[model samples]
Target chain A: MTSAFALSDHDSAQLPLATELIAVIVASSGGAARILTIGGGDRLPSGPLESRHRSLQSGLRAWVEAQTRHQLGYMEQLYTFADPDRTGSAPNVRVISVSYLGLTRESQKASFSDAGWRDWYRYFPWEDHRAGAPPLIAAAIAPRLSAWAHGATTAALRRERRQRADITFGLNGHRWNEELALHRYELMFEAGLVEEAHRAGADLRERAGLFGRPMVHDHRRILATGIARLRAKIKYRPVVFELMPDEFTLFQLQQTVESLSGRLLHKQNFRRFIEQQQLVEETGDIATETGGRPAKLFRFRREVRIERAIGGTKLPTPRS
Target chain B: MTSAFALSDHDSAQLPLATELIAVIVASSGGAARILTIGGGDRLPSGPLESRHRSLQSGLRAWVEAQTRHQLGYMEQLYTFADPDRTGSAPNVRVISVSYLGLTRESQKASFSDAGWRDWYRYFPWEDHRAGAPPLIAAAIAPRLSAWAHGATTAALRRERRQRADITFGLNGHRWNEELALHRYELMFEAGLVEEAHRAGADLRERAGLFGRPMVHDHRRILATGIARLRAKIKYRPVVFELMPDEFTLFQLQQTVESLSGRLLHKQNFRRFIEQQQLVEETGDIATETGGRPAKLFRFRREVRIERAIGGTKLPTPRS
Candidate 1:
């Protein structure tokens, strides 16, 4: 039995533990969902939690703002990742990364030369179903995943693996669930179909590109977590407003949601659902920039945030 | 601007930052939701993340099972609290507490002499609405909260305070939201209505008793977080089955959900909603233990966990 305080001279107390705050700042623009990234779109803007920072959230905001020069809005803690092998840090030095998801309006070029907003789908192309599930899934992912599933030791294990693949990737008659972004990434990683898996010694470098572009360290995984969180959250919370401009046409609003969710929404159903919730109100103005007939502009009702705690706004995605 | 690597001599790296894992293991029995507690029901079972522990969750489970001699089921990370002043540790030390919410069947007597299960409502009397709003809110809490709201310096500040209070506590025609358990607790703490607030130097020792029993340190706050998470989760996720026995009647299931949610559910609507989800199956047995009539026993369909990631089970609580 191990004692609770069994400090073996190399425990966390003796070893230096660095707390890192990573930000996943998201925005929607030009019919695409984007994320602010540093290091030439390879890593998220992150910094060590310093002594001067009053709280974890403040530390994250400071780090992101300093690096990107883009003010974050509607931030929430996503998750804390502290697996010892996750960062591949020195054995004695542990890194605990607390990640946060921040939403904002359209992106501007960051102050730092390398810091810029990149289309989120660029990293996970298969995730986007706005134009139907990208061809990469059928062309590359399914065959590799099927082989991986059949490679399992026992028939029961093979069945379990195949089922998991079907559920995560929407294969074998399963519906593509936008909320399973993280699960899909994880499954691909397990199947050695992604670059991270190859980097982790899976010996499948050739199969990486079709899956998605990989980021430095675990930034891609963190992004997947952020994507999944936002995808799930927008179905219930009014957080999508944080990423919207002051006013937008119904088409623009629907486009933004579809971009983030990686799936096309039924236009009439989406507008009806939004109207039924009373989450938005007509601005009594029309937008001529929508390219065809002038459409009435709408702004989110900020008062709904106070009136209802949950403020649920169900997305009307057509049943697949 | 402070550099990202601005680490002072007394920063987290040099200072011994103790990583603590706290568990809010919950169950429902005898028409009440109960939580497992140690130190005579004043403290949750917690232990430091030790060197032998492979992961944060494993460390939590190991500590809890060792301390209480009870197995945990269906565990999920609740939140990680890491405010430097949260634990009031020494100037050189910091504490990072990662809390988890676990659900299991009704509690048995724990091996530890002081460990036992206590009704969750004992610590949050105002939270329960199963018998409608408790009288303590009107008799004691309202006046004190009103005074706190009015005590703010400026008129605008006072109005803001009052509005926040009303929104959080469901005052002035606002519908009572069971998921705001943490918000309510925090509001009371800020208003100096809870004993822990008094401990933090708010001179309100006399009014503490009416609020609810207070736990040591920030355990009560953590418990509130757990309660809030569970209440919110049960609406979207079929997690209530984790707290049920192998076989149970629909009435028992509703009671268990009500106990955890602190609100009564509409019987017919709740049963209908459950049936629509198809999350449970009849056990082909009748339970005569249900007082008047023989009730059919049902068990949760565990396979739904694999098929649907977020198998939603909406509790049909009549609108207030």
Candidate 2:
């Protein structure tokens, strides 16, 4: 056990460290997934972890509510970002940003002047595949990625780069994996295609808006992490209920999941799986809002939270 | 868009903060799961994050290797502990411990004098259920937990506490959830049944030995967190291979998984599931060590790491 308690003078005289709390509050509505953003939709709600804060999570919730005027619920720590190269802070100071993902409904509009919910697809134009893979993936992303792969110094390096690009972006017979949201964004960042790459001294001014709208600092990267986590989490956990209404038709539930995952599901298969899992129960009410036949409303069974804690809920997502 | 950059003089005059990197290195051998411990099995190998460390992960690997001389192969960030109450640091200094879970084989012996691998069940006796639920649950834990529940002030509070105890410890027909290791430890802590609770002003000096041996400064809690994470991860990820030898029989693989999960797996069903997943391939060798019959050896298919990255590997453990 090396003692962290006894620090030498040199080790003790470390750089001034600051902790930042950032939130990626997500909501789904009208067949689209949205994230809460501020500063004219350029930054996530964030604040410094002050001395008065008791814990990391409480501080995050406080900061997010204060900045957006919307109380966060169903939040979990996403990741802690501490790499000095990613922060772009002052030279003498080190910044640690702890980001969180919060799931909520879009009913309560944020009261802050600049805080608003923006469609998540607007930031990642190539992610949405509900209607089919977005054209931007083929028209813009693939060509640049190929060029980046071929530009490697050696053939081995070029092959490795090409394989990585193919695996990440699901190109040339590779299946498109919706959960690789972070991987795709990271590959683009490495290929110097995103605006953040340009900000970090990459020569990509010509392809500024081709990738996606970049957030301040590494907030976009954090958002990508949140998206990837949520996409993967939904398959094993009953967390999608966090973004759902109290009582909703099965169609609305499927649509919300599809919107968040950026992929469509077979309607019959989705309904059958949900029924088999017994994750939801009939509300004894009907939703007549559908222009077609009225659909039965259902509520997420709360008991599953306790019962399925060990045997986790499994969503049957068809392979692409 | 609340700025984490600007800091007031008062906020800047905050307590001196130190970041500690802790590794919960895990391995399975001889039908038992073990963890690498230092300081006579009372402390996990940990060190303060130094300025020269490139990233949080790098700092962790360097610190663990320096302390134990064991090279880490596969690792992931478990959780970052920043709650002030959890760390018993100096009055004016805040210690933030970022813990990681590392999976490795038990082939290399740690070179340090105090460093040794201890069976995980020694610290979490009630967690093991290979043969049956450990007697410690009914004999020691349940009665104390029930008393704690009834000790609550109001009827509603008491009912809630009882329900919580029942759910957490699997009392009165509730199923034992192997992944709730941390929750069980925390409940015991709250009930003042553990030695650490006594150290923190709880009157549990008499019942100290009843619960498992306590580690120094929340290390045991961190270990429980690691156990819970690994148990859950192994169900959905092919990470057990990180703790296995190059070649082994199917029975060995099942034993390794059962040891880590603290539960028994059906032999035929486990083999069938593994074969269906295509996670392993025949190495064209035979293990003659087993006296009864020579069994075929197999190696984990490396390609599954990429192919199953999106659709994770699932283990079919029988319901308790």
Top TM-score hit: 1
**Fnat of each candidate:** 0.24, 0.36
> Residue B206 in model 2: shift from native, Å?
5.6
Please provide, for model 2 over A69-113, each residue's C-alpha lDDT reduced to its tens digit, 9 standing for 90 to 100: 888778998888678676666865667778899998876755587
Candidate 2 CAPRI assessment class = acceptable
- Model 2 DockQ reads 0.42
> Candidate 1 residues A173-206, lDDT tens each?
9878888899888998888777887676655485
lDDT of 2: 0.83
| Best candidate according to lDDT | 2
Docking class of 1: acceptable
TM-score of each: 0.93, 0.92
**Could you tell me the TM-score of chain A in candidate 1?**
0.94
